[model samples]
Target chain A: MVPIYYYLILSAILFSIGVGAFLIKRNIISVFMSIELMLNAVNLTFVAFAHHWHQVSGQIFVFFVMVVAAAEAAVGLAIIIAIFRTRATLDVDRIDLMKL
Target chain B: MHLVLFFIFGGLCVAGALNLLFQRHPINAALSLIVVMSSLAVLYLLLGAEFLAAAQVIVYSGAIMVLFTFVIMLLNAGREDRTHGSKAAYLVGIPGAAALFATLVYIFLSYRTPLGDAGLGNYLVTTTDLSKVLFRDLLLPFEVTSVLILVAVLGAVVLARKEH
Candidate 1:
């Protein structure tokens, strides 16, 4: 059996990459993808801990996280679409109107 | 065997995430996100989280990614002119991310605490157990999540609807 540390390390790398992409990417869609990446990274950690502790609670929490992520994605994309319709671009830099 | 499979799925997840990051086209990015999600689902299964693996697939790959794809198609947000930002952004972001990765790696590696050998052997929850805990203990959160999903759906519809 592989050690749990392996999974934890992998999850950390993925989460870091996701955070980097989310912060540095200029495209709205790319940012959205990065957010998904972060969620996946969290899921990986949840499963690894669940395995390590030999419990089901972490797995159940992961299910709820996925449910929330799905709903968030739907609403987020729709809002992005609405913004794009008005702005004609998905560039994060250009959508500075909301920035006060 | 487990290590090999772990590396395989881990590679898939990393590759998919990188593709989503570097890919310019929204459709390609969306597809890559789906790949990432599916591979993560496999990882969940390898960890014995069968329910989580199924939820990962059904919710993320089937529902979320599809919604993303539709939004991409509806908005036709395929072509985006690159936005201008300071070169310092990448320099700072990369190092910040690397630092965070190193910290997490250190924590994971240095934690020498022994995990109890308690096993869930033959303790898999049946439908009754699932319902009992879900309805009895998690009922409030469950109801909140349901309302949240409903609100999100309504918000999406309102946002997508054409202005009169």
Candidate 2:
């Protein structure tokens, strides 16, 4: 039987990869993808614990997390589009309007 | 059998995540994200969270990922040559990520919490049970989530509209 620790380890690895990609990638889209990766890692952990505890609460929480994730994706992508339209570039370095 | 299925879906999830990280094209990454989401749905099923499994598929694979793909398509963002980051960024990020991963693994390994031996048994809640609890006890959170979704929809429309 696969132990629960395996799932936790996998989630941790994936989360770190997402964080690394988000930090190092210059493209806005890549960064967004990394964010999705991070969210997925969290979902994996939630489901794993839900299974471990034999309770439905964690699964219900996963449902709520998914709802928020969908909302985030919609709003975040729209913002990305708006930024791209004005700058004509998705590279993070070129987005300097916020720099002071 | 359960272990085999777990390995299969887990492999799929890891592959999809790696592809998302390595792929240069945003659309390809978005599609890979869908694969990851679907595999997670499978994981949810394995965990006996049937409702959550279905919800994961519908919300993530069907709705959220499609939204991402559409945005990528609308933007028509083409693949660019791999953008090089400064040496400092990679130097810091690589080690930082590695350290974080190591720490997490160590903590997970060292934690000695005994797994509950009761198993799921007869306590597994059916969809009806889930609905009852959701409506009866968790009604406020459910309604708040709906409102959040509505706000997100409005914000997305406003952000995407072309300014006059």
Q: Which ten residues in a row have the lowest lDDT in candidate 2 chain B?
A: B115-124
Give model 2 RMSD, 1 decimal: 2.3
Candidate 2 stretches greater than 4 Å from native: B81-86, B116-125
Q: For candidate 1, write residues B1-164 as lDDT tens digits.
A: 77788889999988988887677787887898899889998887777766667778888899888888877787777655554562566788888988999999988888735532213232343445546667898999999999999999999999988898
Deviation from truth (RMSD, Å), model 1? 2.6
Each model's chain A TM-score: 0.96, 0.94
Backbone clash pairs for candidate 1 read none
Give the whole-model CA lDDT for all candidates, comma-separated: 0.79, 0.80
The reply for model 1, stretches above 4 Å from the true place, is B112-130
Q: What is the interface RMSD of each candidate, in Å?
A: 2.7, 2.4
Which 10 consecutive positions of candidate 2 chain A have the poorest summed lDDT? A91-100
Fnat of each candidate:
0.64, 0.63
Q: Pick by TM-score: which candidate is best? A: 2
User: lDDT tens string, model 2, B1-164?
Assistant: 66788789889988888887778788888888889889988877776677887888888889887878887788887884554563556788778988999999998887635633213232354788678878999999999999999999999999989999
